[model samples]
Target: MSDERSYPTGIGTSTTDRIQLLGLDLADEVLGKVSFGELAYWLATKRRPTPGQLRVFEAALVSLADHGYTPTAIAARMTYYSAPESIQGAIASGLLGGGSRFLGVTEDTGQFLAASIAALGDTSGYSEDDWDAVARDVLEKAKSEGRKVPGLGHPVHKQGDPRTPVMFQIAREAEVFGPHLSLFEAIGRVHPEVLGRTLPLNGAGVAGASLADAGLPLGLLRGFALLARTAGLIGHLAEEQQHPVGPAIYAEVDRNATYVPPAP
Candidate 1:
């Protein structure tokens, strides 16, 4: 016999379930009840952060909101220029380009650290030596496959990522630093010796570790990172609006072949 319980298969299943509809009640509680700025504040802090935390979060958002025509930003601006009449289309175009791998880095880093923690098990806790061993193993595997360690490098920030230290500092101030930070530090220590170059922690690593350390659901890690990146999307859209690119450029493309076929 099957060990799973089966739901009734009938017309009722096709109809909207009342309980599911109840989920929409929260929308009423939020919509128009609070000002947009207030709602944004509530969403970011979950329960109204102190002024200091608010400042930090705002700074982080502003710092990440735009980085000079990244793929997503450029796409959004170009789309907006082409379809200036449709604000949504312009924003959507930019969003499509912007978020490509930003959240993936955060999520993948979290998963990597989670796996490391799981591998260590409940043997007291990870000492520096223990973490070094884990790092070595991960590095060796990455080397074998010719893959760079995910959280350690950046294309723009060769010396080190400017945002990483800030986020790590914020996490430290929040008193939520944990094994993930330690693991990151351990990786930094060994990375130079093994890879023959210093590998600084990037913002994604710090953000991923901070979210995981805060006891957040691992699944939510990427969502939060995406939220942080949305600010950039908005900024890109604004820039595109100011310097609009029209569809006349695209309309000039020749659709017909220059030469006729020799025989048909």
Candidate 2:
């Protein structure tokens, strides 16, 4: 007598008659009343955020909204070149690159920080030494197991990610910085000691840690990264339309290919 597949969620529900988002009418109550960032947070966390929390969330979104010519952006632009008719497909192409190696660093960093923090015995009022020990132990364990530390080092920014400082500054102002950010700092400080090299804190790592500090769910961190990069990819694709570098991107790769002749 009852439909077996029916389901319900606190997030939102829709039907032919009307649509609702988190119990608010979509057309009359939610639209323009709440920001996209606030709506996204509520959809995921199932609660409206305070003004401070919203500020921190907005800061994270803005900090990650764009980065010029990243691999994701490049893929998006190239996909656009291949299928100029489908801009959405090109955006999807760019988002597909947000796995462990690229844009997914935010998620990875959050897990890494959380795991390391749990490994730390106690932190009722952690001292510098306590933070340093946990950070060093994390690096040492990773080294012994030949595992890569997720949130350290940047290829282009040798000293540090320029965006990292700004993100932290905002987090500090918003009072959202927490143990995750502290742990990240400790790891960077001890990189030379444990890894025998200075690996700057990259943007992905900071974004992850900062979001974690903001009390966001670790599992959804990747989604944030993807969202931010999607905005960036759109910008790249728009320029790609005018300057049209996608073909040249392919050409450059072709020019640099190494040929291996058959053994005689």
What is candidate 2's lDDT per residue for 1-264, written digit by digit as tens? 867886667877889988988989999999889989998888878888877677877777777777777778888888998999999999999999888878788889989999888756657598878889889888999999999999787778888789888877877788777889888888988879889888888888888998888878999999988887877888888888899998998999999999999999
**Model 2 steric clash pairs:** none
What lDDT would each prediction earn against the true structure?
Answer: 0.62, 0.85
Q: Using Cα atoms with residue i matched to residue i, what is each candidate's TM-score against the true structure?
A: 0.67, 0.91
- Measured by TM-score, the strongest candidate is 2
Q: What stretches of model 1 exceed 4 Å from their correct place? A: 1-63, 98-103, 122-129, 244-264
lDDT of each residue in 161-201, candidate 1, tens digit only: 88887776876676666777667767777887677788678
